[model samples]
Target chain A: MRDRPATEARILEAAQAILIAAGPGGFGVNAVAREAGVDKQLIYRYYGGLDGLLEALGVRLAQWWQEKLMAGLPQTPVENYGELIELLALQLLHIVRSEPLALQSLLWELTGSESFVKSLSASRARAYGAWMAGVRGGLEPPEDVDAPAINALLIAAISQIALAGRQADTIIGLPTNDPATWDRLEKSLLRLVRGVYARP
Target chain B: MRDRPATEARILEAAQAILIAAGPGGFGVNAVAREAGVDKQLIYRYYGGLDGLLEALGVRLAQWWQEKLMAGLPQTPVENYGELIELLALQLLHIVRSEPLALQSLLWELTGSESFVKSLSASRARAYGAWMAGVRGGLEPPEDVDAPAINALLIAAISQIALAGRQADTIIGLPTNDPATWDRLEKSLLRLVRGVYARP
Candidate 1:
């Protein structure tokens, strides 16, 4: 209720922490209030309610993803499609490795029933689609390869690898936590992209 | 403690139904008993408890997946690695389309902390590794292509597609529910595999 920006930030931070620690199911108003050490009524007065709070969190998270993606993307038009693909792949892998909370938020969005989560996913898809269009316009992909499908496959693979890392240490003999494995993954992705998109 | 084998079948069926309908969170002895229209004591007597019931369900689902995978696999040794890869992709797509409950079981395994789920995932990974080994022995992939990494990528993509299908109908412009879209996906996969594995 107090028009304090710091209190709102603290609440949001606590909410994200709860999400990371307990997944979506543990994201409750009381838990968030306790985590933030703030009055429960302040949450109601500031964020309106739990759903509103979640929607705000979703917006923030989506913006964060978009910002990171944009930052990793080439500022000028991509001259080399192969390098652009590699850069995008490594950026995604880096996010998954470094941002556990963000990863959890994505997992929650995928499995959650909230309308806001669906909207967030749709928005992300649109952003991804727009980005792909820009990248495609800048380079000539091989005729045999469906560029969009390949992009989807690569993105999906990286995402699943990230989510699976939370539960399992290895996948099909690839060490999930080892830096060497990540290097190999990056190299493999670079080669795959080059093979599929780079003209001879 | 009924001696009739049909009761056990009913209990197991109910357990699976609950799993599909409400995920692992709804899988309780009381819920299963109510879903089966049987006394709660029957679940205890037949399956011992919720943990034992989950184990039985896991075993059955794993066996079913194994059967489906084996049926779709090449009967003899795979002579063409490209064709083998295509077959594996199709088999995975089939399972995702036809077996919703089994997919739920896998999602549960990925998210749940139960020891049985962990063991089941491990066993399946081992099976996948063995199958990959056999496929690798049959053909020579290109020098730049990492067979194991490719296998992992394909499997992870299929899994994410299946899991994503439950939440969203379309992914990156690909219609998840449309047969045509699936056909396109198969073709794209085949092309990718051929590109990666076909003799240069």
Candidate 2:
């Protein structure tokens, strides 16, 4: 007898592989079932269909992000706001840069599909919010700082550049695909972070 | 007996419609050919198939941005760097929020597809650089400022928030989908812009 939980996990893994390989265009029932080594009917019978399975994939993604964001980092509590921003910014960049799956989720989120927005993206945002609360510790930005908005802008921009940086294509003239160019971007990001959050 | 330029133009418009409505997943030769009321063979014959057509779409999109960014604004030159940032930010938000095609392009670019990266994105980058040069009117950010990275970050973040805000979705706790929340985001964006470009 197939292990139901194991089978379900396998299906999700296959879905991620497919997304990483073929993107959302190739995401469908028959292909996912084939990838999972299961019958096509099983996805519907098991997860209630593609949207449901996609939700599960989203949940899995949230969990993956939760783990990966903290993976192998020093346990030392971040010293100050600048340090915190540096940690958050650098780690976010590293994760998005290294993982095609992370990039996929962002791209998928941009589609504004109800299934993804309601299920997948919601799960991710919740996980991200919780993750931020955890990592932020007792440290806080200056009172005048619109920390959430500023951080959001920085995070969004950095992620966008990283997405484009994968190619030789430029994001507003930053040749981010080049390693030296990427290094300069990193420096500029930290500078902006430090500049914005710098205490008067 | 059709004007070749007009026929090609119609095909491009249809492709843009498909991209705007269905996102990239619905973008295909058959669909575009049908939308344009042209034979499928014409697509292969005229534009060298989808990639060439998409490149044209990118060029057309660049022209659209160039026109729309100054669509009905006052002829008065942007007096300072801060004003320029505000004009650029607000106008960009309006365009991206109202125009699904812009959002779609960003999402497609994120997919890291070679066809998209090499052609469509290159066209976009050129237009964006040209647009920036035209708008700035001799004002410059402070020497300490990393204008490209900073502007890229703000633009990236605002576009992202706009993308998510189409639905009642939260981007890291800001309820961007809500109009009031979005207002605050805009305010925060301007605040970040001013803070980023503040001079001694």
Candidate 3:
């Protein structure tokens, strides 16, 4: 018999592959089992069912993002809020570029009606809230700056641009699929964030 | 015998209703015929087929958006770019709030993998490009500003917030579903665009 933990990991990986490759429609037990080379019954025995498996996948993805964000965070607090803002923007862009599947999951969640998606969104908000609180403690925000709103705008912009780039290489005259375009975008985003947070 | 023009209009209306209510999945020829109380053969005879019907729906939706945007545009162009920027932001926010079906169609297009979706996006890009050209003609954009990039960011942010608000009422601590929250968001977005384009 296959080792239990190994088999479970394989199943989860297979499920994620299917989700990224064919979206929700192709995420069936039969397809996952075939991809993982495991018995379909093991999925039921280990995870209860498809919904349960999806929940587990969601949990795994969330943990992955948390860990990635934490890794990119500054080791110690910085004196300049502008520098911090730039760092945060770059880190976010990096994560979006590196984790295409994660971005897809996020875009999928926007239209998804599943309870799992709701809980995942809530958890992400809480995690981000905590991070913002930590950053706020160390940095002095400008009088007009609404830090959370700016962060939300930044995240939403990055996510949408990356997702839309897949089909439409250019949007609003920006070359979304080109590396030079992304570099320019990253620089412009950094400048924009600094401009907002810069003291009068 | 039914009037050809009237029957075609009815079919198109039925297709639009289906798109808004059930999204693309429910926009099949069969469902549309049932919704319109028309014979299945009538759809084939009126619009040629499903693809033709969809193209007609796309054209209708595009026309609707162009009219709405034109109605919202300033009758006399402002000399100040900052005011123009704020006006554009508010107009975009209004469009997102007013056109729920259009927003749904946009989100569906993001996840959709069809030739029709691609052509629709290209057409939209062209439409927005034309609008931007007209706006640029009257007002001078800031030297540091990349108008298209800024426009893309604003559009993406609005679209994501509106689409995600349907599933999760709050994102990154922003209360998306509440009207008061949107008021705050609109003001903040105006400030952001102005800050980005403001002269040194």
How much does each candidate deviate from the true structure in C-alpha RMSD? Answer: 2.9, 2.9, 2.5
Q: What is the TM-score of each candidate against the true structure?
A: 0.88, 0.87, 0.90
Point out the worst 10-residue segment of candidate 2 chain A by lDDT: A111-120
Q: Compose the digit string of candidate 3's lDDT tens values, residues A1-200.
A: 56999999999999888877777645689999999999999999999998889899888777766776666777777777667767766777787788767676777578667788877787777766555555645566666777667777777777777777766657656776678788777767765676677743
User: Candidate 3 on B1-200: residue-level lDDT in tens?
Assistant: 45888888888999989888887655799999999889979988878898888878877877766766666667776767767667766877788777777676777568767667766776666766566556755677777776667767777777777777777878767887778777777766776777678854
Q: Please name the candidate that would achieve the greatest lDDT relative to the true structure.
A: 3
- lDDT score, candidate 3, position A17: 88
True contacts kept of 3: 0.41
Q: What does candidate 3 score on TM?
A: 0.90
From the highest DockQ down, the ranking of the candidates is 3, 2, 1
lDDT (C-alpha, whole model) for all candidates: 0.74, 0.74, 0.75
For residues A81-141, could you state the per-residue lDDT of candidate 1 as single tens digits?
6566666778777887788875786677557777778777776677675555656554756
Candidates 1 and 3, the one with greater lDDT: 3
Candidate 1 falls in which docking quality class?
Answer: medium
